[model samples]
Target: MTNPLPIPPVTLGAINMEAEDPQALAAFWAEVTGGTPAVSGDHVYMPAAHDGGFAMFFQPMTGPRPDRAASHLDLTVPWGSRVATVDRLLDRGATHLWDVLEEYEHVQWTTLADPEGNAFCVAEHPPVAGH
Candidate 1:
């Protein structure tokens, strides 16, 4: 079964996250992604690593944070760098959540929550070209 409508020519522009302090959240993400954070009006933007990549936009939170986020970021780091990356983030105020190392499929990842309690994962994989 398939839809008859043609696929839209749309691309992901940015991922918007709500933060109690947008600047702080942006700074934390900058540290994680090595992307510079910039402010425009009431939003803080963290540009993606390459052209056409989706940026991260942080907006000020106006209400209570949800108990669970509907989505989270899953970042891939250079092979053998997962431990160091997780350590760096932990030192920068990230909270360790869990770790998954399955020798059966050779998969490894570490889950952590940012200072604002937003959960993201760090997975080890071969560095992507041009990333």
Candidate 2:
């Protein structure tokens, strides 16, 4: 029994974000990601909508929000529709930051900020072989 077995792969279960208004911010993210938000004590939790979807937890912060975030989220869309998604997000109260694109490249992405000024990216992915 000298050899040890490797640990199983772990899936990302949830991400914690700080907000001035936890419940409101959680609701906003839940709407954006189609998750379900529930209030629990001082934090708001958003359960995943699908098998691969990760939960989101919003916690209330005492002072003002940070000027910069340590990390941001990246959302993906079907290939050739990244711009459309950016447009749609813009119409949904997102602020367009910039576009990362180049000719002949199959994948492209755009950066945006949520209403609370949190940065996120929307990327386009190539279609699978069959569909």
Instruction: Write model 1 residue lDDT over 1-107, tens digit each, in one string.
Output: 99999999988787899999999999998888778899988789988857655689999998999998899988887789999999999999999999988852545
lDDT of each: 0.88, 0.82
TM-score of every candidate: 0.82, 0.82
Q: What's the C-alpha lDDT at position 31 in model 1?
A: 87
Q: Tell me how many clashing residue pairs each candidate has.
A: 0, 0
Question: Could you give candidate 2's per-residue lDDT for residues 7-51 as a string of tens digits?
Answer: 799989898888877877787677578898989898888989888
> What are the RMSD figures for all models against the true structure?
3.8, 2.9
Show model 1 residue runs off by greater than 4 Å: 1-10, 51-53, 103-106, 126-131
TM-score of 2: 0.82
- Deviation in angstroms for 83 in model 2? 2.9
